[model samples]
Target chain A: MSGISLSTTSYRNVSIVLFTLLVVTLVLAELHLGPLAWVAALVIACAKTVLVAVYFMHLRFATPLTRVFALAGVVWYVILLGLTLGDVLTRAH
Target chain B: MTHLAIAPQFDDAAQQHESAALGMWAFLATEVLFFGGLLTVYTVYRMAHPAAFAEASSHLYTWIGAVNTVVLLLSSWTMALAVHAGAHGERARIIRMLAATMALGLAFLLLKAVEYYLDFHDHLVPGRAFRPDWSTNAPAAQMFFILYFILTGMHAAHMLVGVLVVACFVAVIRTTPSPARHANALELVGLYWHFVDIVWIFLFPLLYLVA
Candidate 1:
């Protein structure tokens, strides 16, 4: 917790291992699963994305401002998806 | 404590690193907005015609999509290693990892080309050649293919730019000794690469799975 601590080993280890687990889960879901396949895939995809950001991109080690920048994108994702779909879905057309 | 060729405007190397990182993050945030617009259109259309979109999505090859996902993941890991190596001033390791990342990026592009060819040959390419199932609302399904080509095409273009940027970053490190202080720029580029990976991560599920 001093000058620019870089936990490369731990981060990289988790990333590679998670990559394997993610692929296995993906293939299995593709093989089975009914209407839930898409849901499973989306969840897995989000997990993979988080691992890349926190570990691979080293955002876990980044400063608070940097983390804020990253989270802002997600905020936009919510607003964009929520607003556009909310308006369209609620209206009776 | 090494002398860094920091820009005159920057007070010190650490300040420079922070500024660069923040600037890159700001740019990435804008990219989210850029891509978000397309996603909104995509969602609206899909919401309006769920079954047709699902039908169009089924035509995609999930196995190939999985292959590309793994390829990009490996590239991202290598890119991460390159950033780590850069931090320690391990020049050779940096080169090796960056080269490996570049190689994987090229592999992803090649596989994508093959997939596109298959799409075209299967009559799945949007425009005139698009041959949707006759039973489905062919026009609405065509909309899916239209969005597919646009989304994936833009993503591929970003990957191409990333590959070039990594190549140049490698060349820069090779030419410059003690790239010690500039480690953050490499990390910033790594962030860009990972962001691209995230885009494809979401795209894979949205485009490849239908149920």
Candidate 2:
């Protein structure tokens, strides 16, 4: 019972932190800091994704095999993005 | 120990739970690629036409996007609570939290409908009716709106499906006995819900903060 209550508290804390990060990103967006804004927003977005996956989605408590399976999608995505962007960026247009 | 009616194929409840979770994660992996394809397309185009993309994105209702982000995030929190309650066999709390999650999801879709209505009013919809005056590069700007509609439309469709599933689960729980045994099922649903939220997290910034 105590463990359950403790976890509930942790969930609330995580939510609060997530909300704060959202606000921070929004403020950053409003600033229009050029390319830096894009980098900052994407980075913060990744952070938010990790938080949700790890805590909200219970990936933190997930089995190692499950975690690897979950990460497979992201790894494949990075490969796709990297290869495609590499081609696009390197092309002599 | 025998509360769960484990399927004959599975050796026990623990195996059933782990197998179910693994399967869901595998499906979610494919889902990532599904959305990732569109994202890659968007990234390529945005990189090619940065100015046009930024100008086009600026025309989006940032406030709506921001609020919707909060809505989705809150819904995810409710969903987490629901799954947590399920783990503890708090059936009533599970039901309440799931209901709250569903409500928030529907709220997101409602706001999205409003935003879509406004987009149409503003002639932001891609096609012959699309207004290209927003950016110097008319074609590329139109492309931005096209991606915008596609991404958000797909997201909204996922949310609709999620709401329907949650509703079904709620009904099942209400009508069935020993809702605690459904914890594994609820956890799977919660995983799907959170993945949808994560997609929106990336979309919010990419589509709304492109300036």
Winning model by DockQ: 2
Q: Model 2: per-residue lDDT, tens digit, A10-63? A: 889999999999999999988889999999999999999999998887777777
TM-score for each model? 0.91, 0.96
Kindly provide the TM-score of model 2 when superposed on the true structure, using C-alpha atoms: 0.96
lDDT of 1 by residue, B1-211 (tens): 3345678998877677777778888888888888888878987897788888887887887788889988988888888888877787788999999999999999999999999999999898877777765536988888898899999999999999999999999899898867665587788889899899989988877887764
Worst 10 residues of 1 chain A by lDDT: A1-10
After superposing candidate 2, which stretches have Cα over 4 Å from the reference? A1-6, B1-3
Per-residue C-alpha lDDT of model 2 across residues B1-211, encoded as one tens digit per residue: 2256678999877778778889999999999999999999999999999999989888899999999999999999999999888877777898899999999999999999999999999999988888767569999998898899999999999999999999998998887778777888898999999999999999999999998
What value does the lDDT take at residue B201 in candidate 1? 82
CAPRI grade of model 2: medium
Itemize residue pairs with steric clashes in candidate 1.
none
Evaluating just chain A, the predictions reach TM-scores of 0.76, 0.91
Cα lDDT for residue A50, candidate 2: 94
RMSD per prediction, one decimal? 2.3, 2.0
Q: Once superposed on the true structure, which residue ranges of model 1 sit more than 4 Å away at CA?
A: A1-4, A24-28, A31-35, B1-4, B133-135
lDDT of 2 at B26: 96
Q: Highest lDDT, which number?
A: 2
